[model samples]
Target: LGSVLLLLALYVLQGVPLGLAGSVPLILQSRSASYTEQAFFSLVFWPFSLKLLWAPLVDAVYVRRFGRRKSWLVPTQYVLGLFMIGLSRRVDALLGDGQGRGPDVVALTATFFLFEFLAATQDIAVDGWALTMLSRENVGYASTCNSVGQTAGYFLGNVLFLALESPSFCNKYLRFQPQPRGIVTLSDFLFFWGAVFLITTTLVALLKKENKELTPTKEETKGITDTYKLLFSIIKMPAVLTFCLLILTAKVGFSAADAVTGLKLVEEGVPKEHLALLAVPMVPVQIILPLIISKYTAGPQPLNTFYKAMPFRLLFGLEFAFLVWWTPKVKHEGGFPVYYYVVVLLSYALHQVTLYSMYVAIMAFNAKVSDPLIGGTYMTLLNTVSNLGGNWPSTVALWLVDPLTVKECVGAQEQACGTAAAAELCTKAGGSCVTTLDGYYVESVVCVILGFAWWFLFGPKLKKLQDEGQSSWKCKRTN
Candidate 1:
């Protein structure tokens, strides 16, 4: 339990930076950034998607004295902290004025790129560490850590920041509390989280010690060559191959829509404060569902539990799509009912719970199968594949939806008519204005079809494979 808690803490650190960085797109949107710029901001997470590139190196190299995972973990955390602190100082310069024309987008994104790289590297180490720290029977708990800690971190990093930036928050708090200009941006928030990273580092350094025996065999640690060899061997296994396929397809139905909807809401003029306020109900869901799902899936047939839950989870994407369609009507007609917001908020919370539960289940699955010899590389590969498969559609949406919908315009007409007329002209040029739901309609149909096909075709075979492989993998470990 203590080990799981520690792993959870580390994951929270990982989540915080990502959450903070993830806000860039929304921030850009609020500042009237272009669709291209917003999409580019969203793509800043590419490092996380591609962390497998360096994961092998993390596996191959480690200081024996400090510990296999710890050697990397400790340094990465400190560097992450330092980077956050540095980012805090530069937030003003990077973010520029809140208008769309702020700092150089390229440079700001580069800094974000660097931050995500460190965070991704830390994730590789942490995933490796979880496998070694926990016994085979309890390894599934790593999923709980990933789900809960990451969710909490995202709430803090992304949602909390959004709330703070909202007019309501500013009107309520800033009016009374005159903060310094230095504290205006996410600088103070970044610094605070950086302190959290350092504190976690200290705890691990002082209170916990790694078991020498848990280190990969000296042969496994020879270098990158050996890491690749082990990774290749693992990939060749039938179960691992199936697992890879499962991850690649899993998020297609639900995850993609969830990714695009927030931007849709922002584009629709839903105030960040209202969205954040509504999101407060989700905090408990984030913390609670992981515990429930982790416990349920920790049983012998984890994949079966996941399979059973698929139909229900698949509905969330469509529900979210409906919310996107309905929200604007409610806002415009009745002034945005509190009940309407509550219903949408709760629906999203439930969706997040089930969706992320499945996600956690799979991460637990990866943790279970990964060979400790190349733990970092193997696990990182699985997660990277999952993220890539899932993120591909979302990234596409970031770029694709921009041109599909007309929200702004350019030309000499803007000089007299202003931004609104410019937008109308742009829409006129595009031939018609697209509602927020237009993008989601396409996603919903595709996702629903894919969801059913996966369940009917591939799910049962994968479950059987998972069940059979567990016994064999255990025997191999025992030997």
Candidate 2:
């Protein structure tokens, strides 16, 4: 019970920063360009995909007296708290008001990038600690703790914060008296969580002691060089290399629907707070779906679940495009109709089901195929590939949205307004840059087409790899 609680707490802390980062793009949706918002997100999230590069150092180097995990975890948490508190001071200026003032994307990106880097380091330590913290029989619970804690933390940081920060939401739901703004601001939320991080980490440091028996000995722990060598050797295996390629390319199909849809909704006049609230129902679904999916994923061909889930997820990209196109039509003078919200909720729920199924399936496949001799490192490598698969595609989709979208200035001059400056000039010259084409829709069509192509091309190969003998994936150790 204690072990579970500790792991949950650590993972929750790790997740809050991620949730906070996720919320920023939504908050800035109106103030910044779509590409800018995604660029910020992509930069902040890069550490997660790239953390495997430094995972070896995190494992191999630690102060014996301070405890291996704590050596990194304690200082990392402290720095994270300090960074958050510092960011809270400038967040208002960084975000800017939804009016004329624009966000300082460069500063926001730099600040959050460092913050996420710390959070990623903490993740490495907590993940390492979870193994030793539990009995071998109960070690399986670590992933469960991770999934639940991170989801809950993400909810609190993103959904709850966004809802509470909206004056309209607070007025309608929680407040007895009307106010100009929501009960809490972004600054206050950051400061409060930063303090919580500091306090909780301090308590863990002083009260909880690391068990000496659980600590890795000099013989057991690999040096950084050995760890990297092992990682490369694992990559060198034909089967593992093929699998890595599969992991890295898998999410291109789902990227637009998964990464850009919500932001695009906000762009199309959906209220940010309402969109955040829309995710409230999804929190439990996100937490519970993995558990349910794990059952199906435990079979020999876990990738089968992934394969089945792909087309549905890709299909939802079209559904999402249709929903965004329909949103403005359903919106009355007052607000969106009840039926519209219902349709959106239902659609999003279905999408989440497919998403989690794929996620759990891939993770299960990774566990099943991993080389137990270098279990942790091997799993980390595969997970890194999986994360990168999602990250890079989302980034590319976001980057291409502006370029693919078509707009024209409608007035006396009748010129193309391809850039923001051109749009501004059009506005100044008694003209409007009306969007004749939405990049999101264009991107959605291309993504779905690409998704189906990849599916047909790679589906057979995935099944073949899944059936390959285990010896093909195992790497021989070097002296």
Candidate 3:
């Protein structure tokens, strides 16, 4: 429990930046950011999408005195906290002050990139710590901490932060007019969270003790080349190769659909507050569903569980489009009905269960097949490949949304036509610009088709390869 708590704190600090990143689209949309600008901001998360590049540094370097993972973990937290403090001072200027004073989006994105880089580094260190600290018996518990704690941290970073900044909370408690400024601005929240991070860092350093079951042998410490060779050797295996390919293509359809839906929701005038509110109920769902998945996937047929879950995962991608299509029916001349929020909340819960089930199942499979000889490197490589598959497609989808959307701006406020510069260009050209999601719909349809093909074509083959690999490894171990 102490280890879980420490990991939870570490994940929460990492999540704060992620949450802030989630808020950027809506916050900047109010100030008239274009789809491209918002997409660029989203792209700043590239660090996380590509952290495999620097993951080796965490493994390679550490102080002998403080502890291997701890040395990296403690200092990274302090650096992240400091970055937050610095970011609070600059964010308003970067995101712009709402009176037509345009902020430097490039500069702001650079700061956010730095923040994400640190957070990604922290993730590497935390993962290393978890690998080293958890025992074979407690490995399942560590996975639980990872899913629940990390999701909780992300909720605090993304949903809770938005809720705090919403008009409803401000109006009720802060006695402010019903406006989105709420009681605390984004900068103030950053400053407070920065302090919280430092405090948590101190507690983790003091309380957690490193597990000493595995010591790094000379072979393990040979060089970075050995790690690479070990990783490559695993990839050369037929089962591991198929696993990588499956992970690479599996989520592209779903990721592409999810990318554009959030932007569409923002365009439909749903407040960040409402989205955050709906997300609140999903947090426990996020934590609980993974536990349920862990329980069911604990059996020998975990691969079978994944195969069964894949269809539900693919179907959930279509749900976002269906929800968007049905929005008008639910709203129907009145404001959004309570029923709409309830439906969204329920859908989100279902999404969590389906998505996390597949995720935990994959993690279990990776764990099962991994060679203890390579320590954490084998699983990390698999995870890195899996993330690349999801992230790059999502990045491409962001750019696609811009071209697909039709823009309109005539007699509209400067902040109303997506961006101030776009408004200027549209008004000067004497043509109204209106944006539409025709492209997203097309892309989503294609994604769904691709999802079906990937499942039917490759799913069984990959499972057979996995079964063969696991059986081979067990025989080798017993000999």
Candidate 4:
């Protein structure tokens, strides 16, 4: 059990490295004033969403002669570690394309894509392994633990490394170059990515081994197509569709909040060091939230448990509030990093806990939706579609920010008028006593709410456990 947790921890940790690597471009795009440069810069993260396209193959194939979860998992983990190491080695070269605009985005994406493929493959194997390892009594614990691992990695991986790009610090460190404005652009650093690939590859080869399963006989391996068959079955189910939609909608408002706050902090001179320290709370939230969820679901109050997890009404209400009010009132005059950070911290902690409630609800919903025979396939398909949905909105959000020259128009203004309210500065900036990245938040909230409504109204809901359409009964997300 300990080894499984550790291996899974390693596996989940890969996401952060990958997410952080991806975040570099997002940081550059959000902060850099040039729309064209950011557009080119954004190209490096393109492969993240595209990853789900190949998720099926990752499920079906293994490196070992026999087919088992760890066979493929072992190899994939090392590849990701090496990919990060390589990027680290080339950190200087990888960043700061300046206005030159990365001509090498394709190559960079190619390498990032390589890293993502292995990382995704490992994700599949680990998820598969997790199911095999859990008993019904312990499944919630296992899922929650798994969530903890993935979520922990997500926060740590991104925050620890993403802070490296702090403009003030990078501005100083990057002075060595002809146009050293930032540390790494990602697009221009493909050659060095090989190091990450090499390191991650070596780690996997060193650490993992297959524990279960068998080599298929010639007849069993004849079609060698567990992937295609499973995929086909998943699409046939209506429950899978609803589940996927729910996952996509779960944290959109939360995501918008995060995007807005990050911009606000950087604008207010909340140094990365301060931001880094302030961010400590998020780590515990990720670790603890999932466990809270697992424990909540383990009890006997089925509907109550489901409601706490679903909180659909609460989530929607928050979306409306975020869109029309909450974010628009951001105050930064006193410059209380403690206050500002606390608001964000509390907001995210609630967000994390509530969101995992949805995950618990999702698992329940999927189980209620389908039986075991097609259940695995159904879940995988839902995960794939939900992941894809995440991309659609995320890309739209990122793309919107890029072209609008958000940091210049918004970031600078935000920096300038954080607490001018009832003071000369506030009157100087014109309208309110204070100004904020509220506009950005408002824009994102509106988009997310609209999307949520569309999905809520037009997207399918659970009527019957297996019902497919309008005839289905109205309901909640139990899993």
List TM-scores for all candidates, in order.
0.76, 0.96, 0.85, 0.64
Q: What's the lDDT of the predicted structure labeled candidate 4?
A: 0.50
Q: Give the per-residue lDDT of model 2 (tens digit) for 25-79.
A: 8887866655745655667789988999988898888898999889999999999
Give me the candidate number with maximum TM-score. 2
User: Candidate 2: minimum summed lDDT over ten consecutive residues — where?
Assistant: 32-41
Q: Residue 227: error of model 3 in Å?
A: 1.4
lDDT of 3 at 305: 75
The whole-model lDDT of each prediction reads 0.72, 0.87, 0.73, 0.50
Q: For model 1, which pairs clash? A: none
Candidate 3 stretches greater than 4 Å from native: 1-5, 101-103, 131-141, 172-180, 202-222, 299-301, 328-334, 407-425, 429-431, 435-437, 471-479
Residue 131 lDDT in candidate 2:
83
Give the candidate order by descending TM-score.
2, 3, 1, 4
lDDT, residue 77, model 2: 96
Q: Please give, for residues 22-100, the per-residue lDDT of candidate 4 as tens digits.
A: 4554454444432234334444444544554565566555555434665666566655655566665554444444555
